[model samples]
Target: MKILVSGGTGLLGQGFLRVLREKGEHEVRCLVRRTSPVERLEGLELAYGDAGDAGSMVRALRGTNAFVHVAGVQYTPEVLEAMRRAGLERLVIVSSTSAHSRFEFRSAPRLVNEALLPGSGLRWTVVRPSMIYGSELDHNMHKLLRFLDRSPVFPLFGSGENLWQPVYYEDLARGLYAALTKPGTDGQIYDLPGPRPLTYLDLVRTAADTLDKKARIVRIPAEPVRRALLVAERIGLPMPVSSEQVLRLREDKAYPYEKARRELGYTPRAFKEGIALEAGRLREIGLVR
Candidate 1:
């Protein structure tokens, strides 16, 4: 099979590429931005183009058996249209579990992308996953790990009881590969999550445990946290943590992975095991001792 993976330089994209290449059964091509560094993809076949451009996407889609649409902006419509125009027989879209929530930041983009899939004349499979954990390249978990490493006091908003089901990056890649290869996954939506769910504070503690350290969690009121996040956003401080993120932390983000398990034979590692693996990766990268 010939596969075209968009956002191939991204964390999940990298994992997928690694898996596909190692499998050696599929011819993998990456659709990367023209300006993206190719040094990381030295030996791989790359289709140089911008995902926002339909022509570029179409050209990238040529001779590909499957299209993995992982290149998407949180609130952009261009991505959906680009995927729709790619003219692939099969498409596997990587979406977030936030799509299921009423949260403003994630709801619109997720819905818009999902809504565009129906009449695209492609065998589409959408995987809605919760906060993905694994690498330092990850957005949410990595930011939190960095914060925990740098800050003396870990701050928690809204009682620190928000449930999060963090799906591992490799697990997500496997699920995507399964969907890309499986026949029954077409035109289906699957929720991909980890084996266990933990609260915000508990998750921080787990990170600490992974590092053999204890995190000092300080609970803050939601309003104050929101105001602080507003200030942080205004100052352009590297604030990956946001009020929207904080609000999301308070919701129960767990989903039954049975669908993925049944359909894709998906089996995710426990949160602890994933965290331990991440800890080893951080140590290897000199991000942690």
Candidate 2:
């Protein structure tokens, strides 16, 4: 099978490529911008294009049997039209569970794109994942790990009771690949989360444990942290925390992944075990120092 992937330079896109390469039978082509890094995808074929542009996507998707879209936002109509023109049938799209949460406003456009897929008379599946983490390339957990490594005292924003179910990047990638090949997946949406949920405090503590460090967690008011981060943003100082992130930190992100588990045979590792794997990888790559 010949497959084309968008968002090929992203964390999840790279992971999906790794899985595809391991299979070794399918020919994979990635849709990337001219300036996008191809180092991680050294041997894979690359199609220089943007998913939002019809002409570009159509050109890139030509002769591809299936397309995996890892982008958060896309021009769904144009993409579907391009796929149709190229005689491509299967499409697996990556969306966020936040689309169904209180933070839907931030991910509204992605939901719109997802909505366009089912009725386009095409084979489509939407995989919604919770906070994704793995490898040094990951933005979420790795950042937390780095912060925990440097700071002796860690701040637990709010009550730190909000539950979070973060899926490892590899598992999410596998889920996408499964969705691509599995039959009767058309018009279905799968929530791919870790095997279990953990509280915000537990998440931090788990990372600390993985790193073999004792974490001194202190409860901090969320409002003050948000204010400080906003001020830092205005002053052009780079900070990981954002207003949206603070809002999300306060909300529970745990969701049911039984659909994915039953349909796709998706079995994700527990957060404790997954974090240890990620830590080992980071250490092996000398990224933890």
Candidate 3:
């Protein structure tokens, strides 16, 4: 199979490419922007193009059997039309669980992009995954790891009890590969999440323990953090925390993985186990001791 992958330079996209290469069953070509970092895609065939550029997109999609899109944003109409012109048969788009959540930071735009898939004259599957972790380039759990490593104390937003299911990038990569080859996934939407859910505090505690750190967790009110972040955004200050980040911490992000497990044979590692592996990677990169 000849597959074209957009966002091939992203963490998840890189993971997917690695998986495909390991399998050695398909010819994988990835779309890389001119300004994209190519370090992660050392041995892969890259087609220089932007998704928004119709000519580039068409050029990239030509002669590809299918495409797996892991780009962290929505697909454009021109790209979809280009897929048709290129005679692409199927598409595997990686959306997020954020699209189903109440927060509007990234979800709203994702839904708008998802709305374009159906009746678009192509076989498409939308995989909505939970928090993606593992790997060196992961911003989600790596940020937490950095904070736990550098600070004597970690901040726990709210009661720090809201449930979260973070899927490892490797597991998500397998799921995407399955979605690409699976037969009945056309026009299907599956939640590709982790095997188990952990509380916010427990998640932090696990990260600390994995790194052999004994940092005290400090609980702070969500409202105050949100207000402070809002104020910082209004002014000329930089704040890592956003209102949506504070709000999401208070809500449960757990989702059922039964559909993906049944259809794609998606099996995710336990949260603690996955983080421990990530800790090892961090040590190799000198991100942690």
Candidate 4:
């Protein structure tokens, strides 16, 4: 079997490529931009293109048996068209668990983007991973680790009671590969979360513990922060944090990956263990001082 992967240079996609290489069962091609750090994807076949451009996607997707999309899901229409043109049927899209986000402005798009697919004559499976973390390349946990490394103060936007479950990056990538290879997965939506959920306060403590640093957690009142961010947005002032983000921090992101586990064999490691591994990796890479 041959597979075409987009977003192959990022941490999750790179992890997927590692699995593909280890299995050595299928031929793979990566759709990438010239600006993409193709260095990370060394020794893989490359198709120079961006998913936003329908023509290029069509070109790159030609002759591929399946597609695994790790890029933005908002590009769904373009990729579907390309798949249709290429006569490809299998698709595994790496959507975020934030598709269930409390903010309408955000969640609506994720829901709407993938809704266009039922009648498209495709076997599409969506994997919504929750707060993916594992390596230094990760966005969420990596930033937290770095911030904790530099500063003793870690701010809590809310009461820090809201739950969060961050899946390891490799776990998500492995499940994504499973989604592509497993049968009976057509038109299924899987939520891939960590082994267990922890409170937001516990999250900071866990990261600080793994990094072997004492953290000073300061809880900033959520209402005031939200109002300030809203005012900033209304006045066209650039703010580091947005009202949506603040509000989202108040929402619990705990989800169960039982479906993925039952179907895709996706058994994720605990956040405690995962974060320690990430910290160790950062130290080895000289990212942690």
Best-fitting candidate, measured by lDDT?
4
Q: In angstroms, give how far residue 218 of model 3 lies from its true place.
A: 1.4
Best model per TM-score: 4
Q: 1-289 in candidate 4: lDDT tens per residue?
A: 8999998888889889988998898999999998998889889899999989988988998888999998889899999999988889999888788888878886888888878778788999998888888765788898899899999688878799999999898887788888888888999999988988899889999999998899898878999989988998999999888898888877888887778899999888888988999898889988887
Q: What lDDT tens digits, residue by residue, belong to model 3 across residues 1-289?
A: 8998998888898789889989999998889898999777888788998887768878998888888878754665766887888888688888898877777775788888888988788899989889999887799898888888899987677998898999999999999888888889999988888888888888888999999999697878888888888888888697766776787777788898788899988998898999999888888889888
lDDT of each: 0.78, 0.84, 0.85, 0.88
Query: Which portions of model 3 miss their true places by more than 4 Å?
Result: 104-106
**Ten residues in a row with the worst lDDT in model 2?**
71-80
With candidate 4 superimposed using the best TM-score fit, by how many Å does residue 227's alpha carbon deviate from the native?
0.8
Look at candidate 3 and tell me the lDDT of residue 287.
84
- Which 10-residue window of candidate 1 scores lowest in summed lDDT? 73-82
Every model's Cα RMSD, please? 2.8, 2.3, 1.7, 1.2
Tell me each candidate's TM-score: 0.89, 0.92, 0.94, 0.96
Q: Worst ten-residue run, lDDT, model 4?
A: 129-138
- How big is the RMSD of model 4? 1.2
